[model samples]
Target: MALLSLRGLVKRFGDTVALDHLDLDVAPGEFLTLLGGSGSGKSTLLRVVAGFETAESGAVLLEGRDIAAVPPHARPLNMMFQSYALFPHLSVAGNVAYGLKRDDVPRAERDRRVAEALALVRLQGFERRLPYRLSGGQKQRVALARALVKRPRLLLLDEPLGALDANLRERTGFELRALQRETGAAFIMVTHDQNEALALADRVAVLEAGRLVQAGPPRAVYERPATRFVAGFLGGANVLEGQPDGAGGFDCPGLAATLRAEAPVDRGTAACALRPERITLRPSPLAGANASQGVVEEVAFRGDDSLLLVRAAGGALLRVGHAEEDGAPPPRGSTVHLAWEAAAVVPLRG
Candidate 1:
């Protein structure tokens, strides 16, 4: 059974609907990421689950029991904020033990639990250090320790690693996932970073303007977005308009060749969305599912890979990725061949 469930949750702020009848279910020991853009209601949904915000309608249930009227303090959950939210005056031990102390846990148990939490976050020796006494990464772990010290059934992380540097954030993303699994707690994190959501989530739920647009495994959501917004928002996609050619292929007017839409296409004859990485580039033309020649319009080196924007013969701009080890691709204005398999084309409607 799912550990947490949101049924038709609705929240409004004056004229703005912060959450519009959002429904979702989070499985036990699962790390679910709530992904969205600014003001997309990702945080608002997390707040509702944390008992920090009450929805105007619907119910919030934990273990099949409604928790709508439960106060944040009384709920079996803890939220780790983006800013860490550690007390400057208190030591790491104090901050982590704050919840236990509030609940009047016995002195021995509080000490043991605090120590265990610190160890879990690899901050065992830094218990005496203040929040300002540590680096950004360490501070984040302290905040995580504090949230986990109480062993809450559910853990809410509000952009928990948003403040870390890019390299650190990447490293901590894996670490956070591991810790969540180790603790066997259902973790629901809200973030705007697509990489973070993909790397850390067991499942991802995307929101837009206070509505649940899509929810599924990270790869499923990325490879097969349900809508144009989801396809373009989760990652970079080349959306194209086309119609079925009657031969199990699509004739996209703006592209140089016919393409095939992946099965289960909502509207096989409508628009199609394909990820940039799915398109393959070749120096010479190749006969395949969808093949065309285009000039390299732009080349951007992005650390591990390079993004090549090719203007196809039909005038549509196609984006393709080349590995860093492939060396520099053909310079700008040079013609290149692009091809993608039938499985790469994700059909969409509207």
Candidate 2:
């Protein structure tokens, strides 16, 4: 059995379903991220797990025991919201120690735990500082320390890094993952940022319209998305429709030759999800199993890489990524050849 499991989880607000029979499992000590756009039920799932919102039906199981009936405070879990919710009146250490004091822990023990939590987040000496006195990142650390001080069985993070600037969010993502590893605790985070989910999650659950469209490691979900929604959500994808043959190939028209079935081919109106980065662009025409000839429509400088928007002979626009340099990229209106490995094209169902 998994460490935490939600079976047939369903939540509704009047006629609208916030979660529709959502099923998920988090392994012991795993960092699982529920990723999706707004209104995709990611936050709803986190709220349900944190006991802030109750599901209309289903069960929450921890270590094979049902926790659906347990009160929020009685459960061994802690939630960190996007707002941090640190008390402005209390110092960092005081905020961290509040939970322990409420539970009637000894003064010395409470202080020890608070110090340790602060140290875990590299804010040991900043305990006496007020929330408003700290930087955004520092304040977030204090919130995290407060949550960690309790040593909860599960940590619920709702848009944990959304409040930080881009650079700080990236830095804190690494720290959050490291903290989870060192503490060996289960973390379930909700976020709308696809890159953040891909970077920090051990496994990602992509939710859409209250349903789990796909769930797997970051690579699996990105490279082999199970649904059209999952394919488009992760990043840029060149979606193509083609039929598959028995011997393992799709005789696709206007896209060079047949694409290998890529194992486990689904029949009828199947789609291929190809990432822009996976496709290689060359000046000369190339012949291969998975190659498309197109004319470069635009070349965009994206700092480290160039984004090429090419119009294929089939009239479909293909996005390709290539390294950037001082010299001009493949000139606009130049014929370019695109190729990718047979396995690069992922088969997708509705």
Candidate 3:
């Protein structure tokens, strides 16, 4: 059975809708990441689930029971915020044991649980250390330990690694996932970072303009988006609009070429999303199926790869990913040929 479910959830802030009839389910022991931009309602959904905010309509169900009426403290879940929210005056042990004390747990049990939680987060010897003495990553782990110490049925992480440096964030993400697996607890994380979401989630749920745009495994959603917004948002794919020629192809005016679609698309005006990595660039002019000639407008050298912005014959700006081993990317203003397989073009719905 699903561990948690959101049914027809709707929330508003007087003039703007934050959640529009959103429906989502979290499987038991699953790591689900809610991904979206600011104002996309990802954070709002997490708050509603945690009972920090109540929805105007719809139900928040935990284990098939409606939890809309439950208070935050009474719910079988815990939320760890981005800020860590640690008490500067309290030691790591104190911060982690605060919940147990409030719930009137036995002193001996609280001590045992606090030790176990600290050990789970690799903060075993830091029990006496105050929050001010801990590094950013340590502080995050302290907060995580506090949330996990309660043994909640589900855990909500609101940008848990947002405050850390890129390298530390990546390492902490790995540790966080390991901790979740060790405890076998369900986790619902909210984040605007695409790479983090894709890397940590067992499944990713994308929100757009207060609506659930797409939800699936990372590879599925990244490779085959459901709409134009999803295609452009998830991976910054190149979306080209053109007329369908009724032969499983599109007449794209931007590239001044007829491109073949990987699958049959609906009739009328259609569009396709092509990822930057799918296009192969060459210095020689290559004329064939799914090919276009363009001039390199800009080049961005990432450590492992280079991103080339090419202006096609018909003024279409295409971002192409070139590997470092592909003999250093052509200089800006250099003429280039871009080509891809027919299967690389994914059809998009309006």
Candidate 4:
């Protein structure tokens, strides 16, 4: 059974609807990422679950029980903010003990639990350090320790590593995943970074214009985007317009080949999506599902890889990635062949 569920959740700020009848579910022990741009309602959704924000209409259920009227202090959830939100004057141990002290937990148990939480975050030896005395990653772990010390059933992380440097953020992403696995807590995180969502989440919920565009396992959402917005937002994609040409093939003015679509079509137009990396570029013309002719317009060397911008025969700009120049890459204004399997191209509707 799912550990948490949201039904028709609606939230509005004056004329702006932050969440439009949003429905979501989090499985037990799964790490779910709510991914969206600013004002896309991800943080609002997380705040609603944390009891920091209330929905204008709808219900929030934890373990099949409604908690609509529950106050922030009484809700069985804890939120870790992006800013760390640690007390400047308090020691790490004090920050972790604040919640326990508020609940008036017994002295011995509170001390024991605080120590255990600190140990879990690998800050056991630095319990006496203040927030300003530690690095960004250490400060983040302290914030996490403070939240986990509460022993909440649902853990809400509001851009948990957003404040860290790129290097630290990458390292902490792995650490956070390991921590979630060790704790077996249902972690719901909010973030706009696509790579972070893909790397850390068990499932990703993508939101756009206050509504969920796609929600699935990271690879499923990446490889099989349900809409143009999702396809373009999750990563880069080459979109092309074409019509079915019978027998698992699609044909248009400039494209002629077989493409994998769910059903047969009749005189209707459809769009196809292909990731940049899915495309294979060849210096010479190729045959079958792996071929298309285009003139390379831009070539950029990005250290480990090269990005090629090609103007396809159909007048669409296609991006392709090449790791380590294999012989001579097509230069600017030079024609090249691009190829890939029919299944690699995802057809998008509307």
Candidate 3 lDDT by residue in tens digits, 70-184 = 9999998999999989988999999999999999999999999999999999999999999988899999999999999999879999999999999999999999999999999
Backbone clashes in model 4, listed as residue pairs = 290-339
Location of the lowest summed lDDT over 10 successive residues in candidate 4: 260-269
- Per-candidate TM-scores read 0.94, 0.93, 0.98, 0.93
Which has the higher TM-score value, candidate number 1 or candidate number 3?
3
Best by TM-score: 3
Q: Higher-TM-score candidate among 1 and 4?
A: 1
Off by over 4 Å in 1: 262-269, 286-289, 325-327
Q: lDDT by residue for model 4 over 154-261, one digit each (tens)?
A: 799999988899998999999999989988888999987899999999999999867888899999999999887788888878766777676555664454444554
lDDT assessment of candidate 3 = 0.91
lDDT string, candidate 1, 1-350, tens digits: 88999999999999999999989999989999999889999888888988888999999999999999999999988898888888999999999999999999999999999999999989988988888889999999989999999888899999988898899999998999999989999899998899899988999999999999999999999998988889889888988877777767777878867887665433344778878888877768987557888889899988899899988888888878888787777789888888888788987765
Model 4 per-residue lDDT at 336: 81
lDDT of each: 0.88, 0.86, 0.91, 0.85
- Candidate 3's error at 339, in angstroms? 0.5
Best by lDDT: 3
Q: What is the C-alpha RMSD of each candidate to the true structure, in Å?
A: 1.9, 2.1, 1.1, 2.2
lDDT score, candidate 1: 0.88
For model 2, how does the per-residue alpha-carbon lDDT over 1-350 read when each residue is reduced to its tens digit?
69899999999989999999999999989999998878989888888887889999999998898888888877888999899999899999999998899899999899889989998999968878888899989988998998899998789998889889999999999999999999999999998888999999999999999999889999988888888888887897877766776556665664645666457554653777788888887667666567778888999989898999988877778888887653567889988888888778887768
